[model samples]
Target chain A: MALLSIADALKSAIAEEMRRDPLVFCLGEDVDIPGGMGGAFTVTKGLGEEFGYERVLNTPISEIMLAGVCVGSAMMGMRPVADLQYGDFLFCMMDQLVNQAAKMCYMSGGKVHVPMVMRAPCGASNRGAQHAQSLEGFFTHVPGLKVICPSTAYDAKGLMKQAIRDDNPVLVFEHKLLYGGKRKEKDAISTIGEVPEEDYTIEFGKAAVRREGKDITIVANLLMNYKALEAAQILEQEGISCEVIDPRTLVPFDYETVVNSLKKTGRLMIVHEDNYNCGWGAQLGSWIAENQIFLLDAPIVRVATYDTPIPFSPVLENYVIPSKERIVEEARKLMKV
Target chain B: MSKLPEKERMLGMYRQMYLIRKYEERIYYLFLEGIMPGTIHQSTGQEACAVGMLYDLRKDDYMASTHRPAGHDLAKGVTLTSMMCEMFGKEDGCCRGKGGAMHTGDMEVGALVANAIVGGNMPISAGVALAFKMMKKDNVIVCFFGDGATNEGAFHESLNAAAIWKLPVIYVCENNLYSATTSIALTCNKPNPAADRAIAYDIPAEVVDGNDVLKVNEAATRAIARARTGEGPTVIELKTYRHGGHSRNDACQYRPKEEEKAWFDRDPVKNFRSYLLSQKLVAEEELQTIEKSIESDVDQAVEYAQNAPFPQIESALTDVYWEGK
Candidate 1:
């Protein structure tokens, strides 16, 4: 086992996939340069040196072309892992991602498959509204696309490998705060984890029980998963047992695990950095209410960021995004209910 | 004057153009009779542009088409029966009844599923070309779009990327003069938008009379050769006109009568046939036989589509993702 950061884990995953299959390649802005930060966060750093420029392609700052290239290449039997400098830039290529890549298989009557992975670095950093939004909610809503958010180095490496091998378009939303790169965020959490050296893949729709308990089940992902764990620790001190569930993949959601956890805890709460209205948590809450309403002893609670765009100011940003205190408070409220 | 292709190749182009013309005519009549289920963006008059550009492409060479894709798909060798079945929304369709008229294509024949979004295929074609280039393959991709697509950001981005990477792609703009009723004059300020813009990307560009199959074929030959030799992309603007309206119900009242009449006078299929006869490359009896055969083929396709079954209701739930190999 080697201790790797999220960025290194993703890099290792891509490198291994490229070595395994000649059809696998990567494209993005600043993806490969002699002295550049391999992509914005260095996930693809040093890959060009090993694989040459043909595999690690550096493209112009064109998100539309980046996404279009992935869709087109993937359709032609080439596995392309496209990267966006920021998750918010995915909006620029919405036509390619949502309309083309997502619908190509369905539109082609399953004859064509876009086996590609789009990596978007998400979460609220110091960057203003345009750059700092956790946009997983928007992509999770899109059909014909698989969405995965990896919080740990282990999950990032495994899920990325699975994404590359999968014969469908998968969007991997990596939290900027959890990348654990050289350029650290002010509030970045400790995301270093021991990743196995051997080839391994984590299947989608499997939620990990980070801290199992009996009082309340708090379902979260990305950076919020760590926050939920922090809240669980705090609640443990107060004699309130809380179980934290990290749903690795959002589209193929592990509702079974959440339901099983709710069966044990008898209460459920979802925490996410995405905005409150129509966020992924909203779907999870609604699903639990519709299917497992009788199992719930209290109303399903969702702790998420405010609906407004993420602000630049640290104070305003902290106020909007969900924090450990908020998760703890929401979990306490659910316990009271 | 451009050097003409061999008699056999010339006749083949004429045959393909004739097939496209007849196919569109049959589809129009089928829609009129309420036999066809979906609407069509017909390529009634731009048959030569499709045939001349796509006839020489190998089976593995990719072609990204526009909403009006029947001409391109037929020319790219997508079976007429599959296209007709697709039009009928039957299970035996090329897209298995999922893609309607606007999205008709067969990847087996190297036709990427037709893109309905304006200029959506431009970047995709570049990417396909990028793949061929990365694989070190000499195969080229032909991207077909309208004059209006030249103004989209995707077109510029795609062209720039193709130019920089030296990807093997041909950007064929069938300048039908209108973006669904809005004249190209209103949207574009340049006389030849695609050709003129190709200069900005440092790529070679050409303007051809789309009604003249020979001229289109000549230009496509040079462009395809350049792409095959790693000379990067070429933007070819084929000046043509559509005989029918943009969609099923469009009367094309926005077009001027003199303009319409002038374009109709140079109908690609009719003029190409005349060229073939005048050049003595194909005898009148032989041309007539080819036309009759195409008509019978269309008739058989229509019959097959009418008899083919619709997909099961549960099949809609599948194909969202590739199940597996």
Candidate 2:
């Protein structure tokens, strides 16, 4: 086992995939340069040196072209791992991603396959409204595309490898705060984890039990997953045991695991960094309310960010985003219910 | 003027153009009779542009098309029966009725599914070229779009990327003058949009009389050769007119009567027939036989489509994600 950061884990996964299949390649703005950061956060650093410029391509600042090229290359049997500097930039290539890449297989009657992976670094880092936005909720709503958000180095590497091999378009939303690199954010947590050296892949739609308890089931992902764990630890000290579940993927959601957990705990509280209205947690809440209401001891609770653009000020940002205290408070409220 | 192709090649081009014209005419009549379902963006007057550009492409060479894709698909060798079945929304269609008129194509014939969004196929063609180049193959890709697509950001980005990477792609802009109801004069600032923009990317560009099949063929040959030799992408703007509306029920009142009459007078199919007879490239009897064969082929396609079955209702749930065989 090798201890790696999320950035290194993703880099290692991409390099390994490229070595395994000649059809695999990487492309995006500043992806490969002689001395520049390998992409914005060093996820692709030094990839060009090992694979040469052909495999690690650097493109102009054109998100539309980046997405369109990935779709085209994927259609022709090439597994392209395309990236955007920030997750919010995905809006610029909405036509290519939604209209072209997502619908190509269905539109072609299943004759064509877009076996591509798009990596977007998400989460709030005080970069203001445009740059800092956890946009997973937007992509999860799109059909024909699989969405995965990895919080640990182990899951990042495994899920990325799996996404590359899968014969569909997959979007990997990596949290900006979770990317443990030299240029750290102010509130970045230590997401370093031990990843196995051997080739392995984690299947989608499987939620991981971060902490085991019996009082309430708290489901979250990415940055919120860590916050949920922190809240669980705090609740444990107060004699209120809590179970934390990281769904990992939103589209192929692991409802079975969450429901099974709810069966044991008898209560549920979902947390996410996205907006409160129509957030991914809302979907889970509705699903449980419609089908799994018998298992729930109380009404479902969702703890999400305020429905407003991410602000630049640290105080305002903290006020809008979900914190461990908020998770704990929501869990206490659900327990009372 | 450039020299014409051999007699056999010239006749083949004429046959393809004639097939497109007849097939479109039959489809228009079928829609009028309420026999065909869905809508159509017909390529009535641009048969030569499709045939001349796509006639010489090998079966392995790729082509990406826009919404009005029947002419391009027919030229790229998608069967008439399959296209007709797709138009009828039947299970035997090329895309199994999933892709209607706006999304007709056959990957087996190296045609990517037609893109309905304006200028959506430009960057995709560049990526296709990138794949061929990365695989060390000499195959080229031809991307077809309208004059209005030139204004889209995707067009500029794709052209720049293709030029920088030296990808093997040919951008064919069939400037049918109008984008839906808006005129090119109102949308585009330059008279020759492709030519002016392609020069900024250091790629060669040209404008050809789209009604003249020979001229279009000659221009396509040069561009295809350049792409095959790894000379990067070339943009060709074919100045033509659409005989029908942008889609079904469009009367084209936005166009002036004189302009319509002038374009109709230079109708590509009629003028090509006259050229073939005048040059003695094909006799009247032989041309008549080819036309009759094409008409019969269209008739058979219509019959097949009318009798073909609709897809099972459960099929609607499938094909969203590729279940590997």
Candidate 3:
């Protein structure tokens, strides 16, 4: 096992996938430019040198083209991993992602398949509203696409390789704060973990119990997973045990683990960076309400970013986004029930 | 100077064009009688554009089409039964009744399920071309769109990428001169909406009489050859007109009588019939025999679709995510 950052883990996964399959290639703005950043967050750094320009392509700053090209190429039996500079840029290719890529298979009566992956870096690191936003909530509602958020280096490499191999379109959402803090970006959460040197793949729709507890169950993803764990620690001092669950894949949600955990805890608190109304948490909460209403000790409590566009000011942004205190506070209230 | 393909090729093109015209005519009546499930964006007058552009494409070569896909799908070799069944929302349809008139295709025949959005197919077609280039295959994609699609960002973005990467795609825009209720002249600054915009992408462009199969085929051959040779993409604007409205509801009241009359006189199927006879390519009886076969074929297809069963409701849950290759 070697200590690897999320960026390094993703880059290694991409390099390995390309080596294994000649059909796999990477394309995005500044993705493969020599001496360039190798995508906005450097997840594809140095891949061009290994894969060559044919596989590691540099695209013009056209998000729609990036997404559409991936969909088209994938339909014709090519695996394209597209990189979106910022999660916000995904909105530019909304039609391609939501309509073209998602519906092609069903619309064609299973005659076609799009084996593609889109990497989106999300979360507020003071880049203001446009650049920073956990856009996963918007995509979870889209039926055809798979949404995965890996909070750990081990999960990052494994899930990325698995996503590349998946026959359908998958959106891999990486958090800005959890990009391993190696870059000069201010306040990036420095996270590095032991990733296996050998090839491996983690199954999707499985929840990772980050912190096991019996008092209350807390579910989170991306940066919020770490935040929830931190919140758990703070609550631990008060003898209020909390179980933190990191749902790696949002689309094929792992309800079994959450529901089982809810059975033991009898209380649920959903935490996320996406805004409050109609977020992914809301759907999960609604589903839990419909099916597991009797299992809940109290109504499902959601600790999410306030229902507003992310603000530019650091104070405003921090206030808008969910914090450790918010999670702890929400969990405390759920425990009161 | 005008040249002609061999008699066999000429008749084949004529047959396909006639098939498209007849198929659409049948659908128009079905729609009027409320026999069909949904609205249709029929390809009535633009038969030659589809036939000419797709005549040379192989089964491995793809065709990306738009809302008006019947003509392109038939030209690209999608079966009549599958298309008819799809229109009737039958389980045996190309898309298992999921894709109605606007989204019928058979990928095995290299006809993609049509895109209903105005300019949605542009980037997708470019991606298909990119795949061809990446795989080192000579197979090209003939992407079809309308004049209205020219103004979309997907068109500009996909064209730019195709130009830079030299993707093997022939972009055929059937310039039927209307985007829904709006005329192309009102929407676009240039008269040639698609061909004129090719200059911005630095790609080759051609404008041909869409009603004349020979002219459209000549231009298509050049562009298709260029794409197959890895020379890059070409944008060919075929000047044509839809004999009907933009969709099922519109009566095409927006188009002037003179404009409609002018395009109707140059009807592709009729003019091609004349050209074949004038050139002695086929006997008048031979042409009549082909038309008879097409009418009967369409009639049989309608009957087959009307009798076909609906897909099981639970089947809708499938194909949302393909489990395998």
**Winner by lDDT:** 2
Worst lDDT 10-window in candidate 1 chain A: A328-337
What is the per-candidate TM-score for chain B?
0.97, 0.98, 0.97
Among residues 3 or more apart in sequence or in different chains, the pairs in candidate 1 whose N, CA or C atoms overlap within 3 Å are none
Q: Candidate 2 overall Cα lDDT vs. reference?
A: 0.93
Q: Estimate each model's TM-score.
A: 0.98, 0.99, 0.98
lDDT of 1 by residue, A1-337 (tens): 9999999999999999999999999989998788999889989989999999988999998888889999988888899998888989999999999999999999999899999999999999989999988888898888899999999999999999999999999999999999998877788987899999999999998999999899999999999999999899999998899989999999899999999998988898899999999999999999988888998998889999998999999999999999999988887777777
Model 2 Cα lDDT, one tens digit per residue, A1-337 = 9999999999999999999999999999999798998888899999999999999999999899999999998998999998897999999999999999989999988899899999999999989999888888888888899999999999999999999999999999999999997667889988899999999999999999999989999899999999999999988888889989999989799999998898899999999998899889999999999999999788888899999999999999999999999888888787788
For model 1, what is the C-alpha lDDT against the true structure? 0.92
Cα lDDT tens digits for candidate 1, B185-257: 9988899989999999999999999988878988999999999999899999999999999999999999999
Tell me what TM-score chain A of model 2 achieves.
Answer: 0.99
| Interface RMSD values, listed in order for every candidate | 0.7, 0.6, 0.6
Better of 1 and 2 by lDDT: 2
In candidate 2, the residue pairs with backbone N, CA or C atoms under 3 Å apart (3 or more residues apart, or in different chains) clash, namely none
Model 2: how far residue A121 lies from native, Å:
0.2
Q: Write the per-residue lDDT of candidate 3 for residues B1-325, one digit (tens) a residue.
A: 1244599889889889989988999998988888777888989999999988888777889998999999999998999999999998889999999988899999889998999987899999999988888889999999998988998999999899999999898888899899888998898999899988899889999989988988888898898789888899999999998999988899888889998998899988999899889999899898899899999999999999999899999988999999874
Residue-wise lDDT of candidate 2 within B1-325, one digit each (tens)? 1244589888888989999999999999999998888899999999999999998899999999999999999999999999999999999999999999999999999989999999999999988999999989999999999999999999999999999999999999999999899999998889988888899999999999998998999999999999999888999999999999999899999999999999999999999999989999889999999999999999999998999899998999899988695
Q: Against the true structure, what is model 1's DockQ? A: 0.83
